[model samples]
Target: MSDPTSPIGWGIQLAKLWTSSGQTFPVRVKDIALEVTKARFPEPVGCVIPHGISGIDGMLSKRQKKKDWCISYDETVTVPGRINFTIAHELGHFLLHRQQRDTFQCGQLQMLEYDSPESRRIEAQANTFASYLLMPRNDFDAQVDGHELSFELLGHCAERYETSLTATALKWLEFTTEAAMLVVADHDEFICWTYCSQAARRIGAYKPPGEMLPAGVLEEIRSKALDARKFRRVAPGVWHPSEEAIESVIVSDQFEQMIFLVRFPFALSVDHEEEPESDAFSDLAEKIQGLR
Candidate 1:
């Protein structure tokens, strides 16, 4: 095993572990894990149980000295995609964090959780691992390389990759060349979090924390409207405090709150000057997103 601490490295190694196929989708990861552990370690993973925990999304057994390991997850997680991510996350701990901690406990889908700093760090790594594993960049980029991101394009990718829209969108946002951002808000309209791509951030686009979602976006999600997936262009200082016009897309029917996927053309300067950074927005994006 390469044993790289970086999640992207670990994910690449895991994807190539199977000898018979190059395809990453529909990966029987549990089987590969069992085979690898049995071959590599004295204390190999032995069994996987779906009903071992309550309220918890997934967990790994306390480490033992002599070849005893088990993987377990909440049996009641009806969303197969979520369970798969949880399992992959546990496997990530097994590969990446096992030496640091004997057991791993994971919660249901969440973000920006207040926990010990160490635990939170590992959680982010595991999330990165899961995201990369489930949606390998090679295949994902093929589907989304030049296409403008809409819920439709992302929804199809989600079905193909067997992941939640949030996960899929996050993965795509990680590598997009387009100037785009994803902002999550709560039922009370408080901004939960936001993620902007390298291009978006470079163009000096930002949505600060604690700001309310635009009334246009709030009304779109609340309307029980199925046909609301087009560009909701906003002026410079609405949802985003930028000089450029932002094209926004509201993910509808999301119960209480909504998400806005905003995009705009990159900006240029005559003097080729770099925009000053927003310390507050930088801090906010560093926090985890997709919270619910």
Candidate 2:
């Protein structure tokens, strides 16, 4: 078991261990997560309870002015895999942010946004730890390499990583070379959030259909054309300014939660120099190792 004193540090070390073992991307992440948790805190770390704690997937706490620590989770969702991620998250807090606070209350979204800066830096660090520890870069790169942008492929990566579709997509965007963007939205037409790949960002591409496309661009006019299995290329200026074109595919589960993958034309090959890194996990690895 690696020390959790620095979540990023431990995550990088664990990623190296998994890579050396020849595990595949997404899959290696789950393997490393399970192995690290069982080795470090063998007892069900989810059982230790503290006062005033309400229902939640996981909790982290330390007594005032003392090094005494505790980590626990809701017994309801206490499967080994979920427990693994929870423990990893708590370990992140223990190693990275224990000085800032005695406890943290984590919901699903908070845990998902573990890499973003808007969230508490510590929380983001913890999430980054969990993500990197679970999905090592080498493995993720192999799965994504030579793969086309599609919902089915993303779903496969998600299952392999034992994470949600959004998580997998977010991770994929970290490494993909194509100009792609992911949009998550509800039935009411309100945009929940959006993430763009490095290429897409450099081209000044964004979602929500403002200034780029008229409002109701996706829902009103093109709703009938959306198909998760295939890509539809629209005319230039539909998604951005270049003579480059746009292709979009919509992924809808039964609940009406939608994931839109929009692809930009591959023109301006000169700008290829700014393409995203081949290994999405490398930046995180560098950050973690630097911390150590």
Error of 2 at 140 (Å): 0.6
lDDT of each: 0.67, 0.58
lDDT of 2 by residue, 1-292 (tens): 4364555567778767766787655433323333554566533123244233344667777644443566766655522245455656676666567667777767554554444564445655676777677666667787778877678887776667666565566677776667777766655555555567787777777665222233535543345856677666665665566635455556454545556677775745335454434333223332221100
Q: Which ten residues in a row have the lowest lDDT in candidate 1?
A: 277-286
What's model 2's lDDT at 245?
Answer: 47
For candidate 1, the per-residue lDDT at 168 reads 78
Residue pairs with backbone atoms closer than 3 Å in model 1 (clashes): 43-67
In the range 223-248, model 1's lDDT, one tens digit per residue, is: 85534257655667665565455554
Question: Per-candidate TM vs. native?
Answer: 0.82, 0.68
Name the top lDDT candidate. Answer: 1
Give the TM-score comparing model 1 with the true structure, all chains together.
0.82
lDDT of model 2 at position 14: 74
